[model samples]
Target: MPELPDVEQFRTFFHAHATGRTVRSVEADPTIVRNTDPAALDRALRGRRFEDPDRHGKWLIGWTDGPALLLHFGMTGDLVWSGEDPHRHRHDRLILAFEDGNELRYRNMRKLGGVWLAHDREEVAQVIGALGPDALSIGRSEFGERLARRRGGVKAALMDQTFVAGVGNILADEILWQARLHPRRRIETLDEAERATLYTVVRRVLREAVRSYDYVGRKRSWLTHVRGIPGGTCPRCGTSLQRATAAGRTTYFCPRCQAADPAVGSGP
Candidate 1:
């Protein structure tokens, strides 16, 4: 799943590579672009230039003088610089061909997310109205306050889009592991230092993850490296990392290093 870091990367890329470029043509798979009429989209945006790349959580918005192009990269969706092959890639759902012969293509294997047309940023807000303050933009004081008011486990609070935007299941685990907190640790049990640690680590982990480009280009860490693998052991404490479905998402944490959940098992 594309999170804040991933969408931020896309936003940066879109600004640098595609902004100010004139759209010559647009070809879209009708099945993928759900919100706007294909003909209407092309007519409204064909001659316009892409400008002002912005992101809110996992959503990326690139706009022109006219309608804004909102993108949500679902599980397998990606926006890549279109290569030579045009029709060869079946997943290339939405392709915006530029006047310069280059293209920016939106591809999705699962079709979970698609393109949305918004007249302005305010309209984009209406589309994603349920989202709370962006994860990267909120200050530490606000983050602490939000967590202090939450009744659920810290991981669940972090992963809630309505509470704090952009974090997903994988990121929730990574941030919790880095802060040395159990996935099921209640927010009320957090001390000032622990709260500080969570806030600091959340931004740090996300920045590093985006800087590393999806965490693939960087050295594998104890927390991020264990994601998606079954029965993976902790790289830090050498403990068997336990897994459970917490708040409906699969959660992973080190038993020895993060045994702070009072309701669950033995703790430090």
Candidate 2:
């Protein structure tokens, strides 16, 4: 699924190409990933202009003369800009053609993501209401407040949309590793200082992700580089990395670095 960072990258691309552009026509082929009726989408978006680049959690909100388009790139969805439509990609669920003859394609290989049209602000709020504060924009105090309220494993809490939106599997793992806290570590066990550090780590990791265009593989300082390695070793401690399922997602951690139990000498 496209997390906050990947969505941030998409937001950047949308701002550069799609924002403030007048729509000439609309195309809907959500035979694979439809949220609203294709005809309804076309009716609402055609001849309208996209204004106000807004995103919350993993959802992108695009405003038009009619309804706002709400987008969620589930697993394998992305936006591509094409000067000319060569009829190239078959998985484009939504295509918006601009007055300038440029094309914006919302392509999803697996077709798991969805696009919805919001007829009013209440509708948009309903779509966004299910999500927690966006991981990137939440304040440090708010992060700590929310983290303090989680009643499950730290990883699961981080992944929960109702707890903190946009911090998905990879980001949770990376942030936990940076904070030297195990994925399974219970939130109640975290101290004010530890939680504060985690807040800093989450912001740092998320910012780094947006800065690198979701290319953590190219960064040596990122623990994501070693995540799920065939014979992965912790870059910080050189101990062989361990993996397990947390919140139903494959989680990576260093046993020597982030101990299983923090009460009994959890390593710093």
Model 1, span 1-268: residue lDDT tens? 5888888888987887789999998888877776787887888789999987889888888889888888888888877785544553778888888999888888889989888888877888888778978888788999988888888688878888889899988888888888888888788888888899999998888778877775732446647686656777887867788887787888888888887654455444
Q: Report clash pairs, candidate 1.
A: none
What number of backbone clashes does candidate 2 have, counting pairs of residues 3 or more apart or in separate chains? 0
Q: What lDDT score belongs to each candidate, Candidate 1 first? A: 0.82, 0.82
Give the clash total for candidate 1.
0
Clashing pairs in 2: none
For each candidate, what TM-score against the reference? Answer: 0.91, 0.94
Q: How far is 190's C-alpha from truth in model 1 (Å)? A: 2.3
- Candidate 1 off by > 4 Å: 83-88, 262-268
In the order shown, what is each candidate's alpha-carbon RMSD? 2.3, 1.8
